[model samples]
Target: MAFFGFKDIDKLSEVDMAIYRYIVDHDEQVPLMRVRDMAKGAHVSNSSVMRFIHKIGYNSFPEFKVSFKNENQDLMRSQQNILNIFTRDAFPHDIEKTIKLVAHLMLDADNIVFFGMGGSGAIAEYGARQAASLGFNSFAVKDPFYPLIAQLQNTSNNVIITLSVSGKTSEIVETLNNFVNSPDTILISVTGNIESPVARIGRYALTYNVPETRIHKYYDLTSQVPCVYIVDGLLMELHNQDIERQK
Candidate 1:
């Protein structure tokens, strides 16, 4: 895939390849170019430009241009050494599956608990609030004792959503291990590291590809945008599903 997750040019026909190459080479200008103008520049017909745009997964030229501009804007904003830009884009890749799974879990659970520590704790709180707004029984719990109490009170029909950017937080890992044997409890972990211990313990894992920086470990420069994106997306899906059911 090219930048912004566009299909590889090599997969296109000869004519479409030329048009795609023109777009890539003149990305800054293509977003503003009319179909006829782009066709003329690429030595193709206007219909061919439309076909290429649709072939690239957009409904129309305007849609394609909007996505192109948004991707470029993200790049421009991240030029100042922000790693979160890349992480932000990662959310959309597996969004459909993640949202579906999370929404189902939320609907099925009697109670939903959000767990995290430090920076992740804030994200957990925000996620819980978002879920609550969608009418789910959700709350963020930072104190380990609270989770233990909740687990003891209601072991079955409960869903736990945990956030750990590193996916290796000892406290999270231990907490997960405490409930690993509970077949009725569903654990969902959101993390940048899919293979880390915390992710492994979860029943479902939502992962974002963020480069781990040592600076992030000490100073907390890592972007929580991906975590927030996943939480928001999941809540939106749940809301949409509820609307559909009502209709």
Candidate 2:
């Protein structure tokens, strides 16, 4: 996947993230947006917007706009490829089955805990927030040092969804290990590697099989677009249940 200049989105501040999300949500309109326009939309100053542009690896707004325009024009989102970047087959043949299974766990659970660290950690928060918006009692945990998970021990009605690119994040693997034998604890792992330790620990696993994208020896910037895709699928699956009930 072509990175957008920065190492990753990890270092982005809340203000930067606001701009980033605004740009993403308004992607088609971005090329035409002026700096002041972005500032207004993200509720930030014009200077803040400029800082975010550079922070993401662009020299200037015009440069970022050119690249963003080209990316939108060239990249096609499909099962075989995501954003024209990942080369591997990104979805399983039984994706519908996987979606249903995840939805089922969420529907049956009293609480859903989303866990990850770093980029995946942000995704964990997104998953939790999204799920809660759908009226599920969902919680997000990104801090490995947080000790509250002990409350989940041996609980059958709790679902722990772990997001990772490599699936070997020590914090995630360690947390999963802590619940290895609890019959009531359901584990669902979303990762780029299906055979990773986190996947092996899950009762259900969804792997995107995208080639790893790493940099600086420590950052796994693997396209998490797949993780977001899986989470969206699960949300839609549960949404379908709502649709069915209205019938």
Candidate 3:
């Protein structure tokens, strides 16, 4: 009686689904199995099992398995929780990963500018102010189409950090691609998928890897927190850098 079967269904490819299913079915008085044993049970290769764990938001098989056994709820509750975490939706793992990347990017970038549209755009603006306090020149590019032109006209050596949840926005994609050759313009994308169009064009992509369920449906602020927290992480890391520099 593993709790929920699986959520973030789209996040899991075919192999991940199979592996997860195998884990659920074998949980009661489960055998002590190595990765190889687990993979064999799942009808997947060992490498595939490990990859599947990461893809579905687990740091490792042991960590995932531990959580899988935490609750004593029935299979239905388990299934529901999976949905709640991934789709319906409370997604801690995705959010945590996003925060981690933002902190890293903030420390790494020479200068920071943010780009997004609609709600994500609003968040980018908020991120800019937050970053600015840390002595980084931060701007939220309002019009995705004209950012490159504006960047060319400005005389600062700064990187552009674009936030796109879906990574499919054509205008942002084009804007980022337009500046591919500019040494002054280093592109860092905070996007949800490694396979997204924006990730493809950016100089460096800090992928968020949101639950597939979060991406497929409409939600008010579920996805925004991941990106915002990323900015917050960046700000915190910047503070640390300042402390180090002052020492």
**Leading candidate by lDDT:** 2
Candidate 3 displacement at residue 149 in angstroms: 2.0
TM-score of each: 0.62, 0.64, 0.54
Q: Sort the predicted structures by TM-score, highest score first.
A: 2, 1, 3
Residue-level lDDT for 54 in candidate 2 = 82
- Once fitted onto the true fold, the runs of candidate 2 whose alpha carbons sit more than 4 angstroms away are 1-82, 86-88, 153-156, 245-247
- TM accuracy, model 1: 0.62
lDDT of 2 by residue, 78-173 (tens): 334434764436787887798897898788788899998898889899989988998888989999878845767545688899998888888778
CA lDDT scores, all candidates in order: 0.80, 0.83, 0.69
lDDT of 1 by residue, 1-247 (tens): 1245764756889998898778878989977899999999999999999988877788877778888898888877878664426744675476678778788888778888889988889988988898888888888987655646555465578888889899887777888787787877788988888889988887888888766666745766677777888888778887888787779
Please give the range of 10 consecutive residues that has the lowest summed lDDT in model 1.
Answer: 83-92
Q: lDDT tens string, model 3, 1-247?
A: 2226455677777888898778778876233567888898888898998897777667877776676666433444647644333341333346455545555556656667778888778988888888887777677876876545665556546667788888888888777776788777667777777789887886566666455454446653445666665666666766876678689
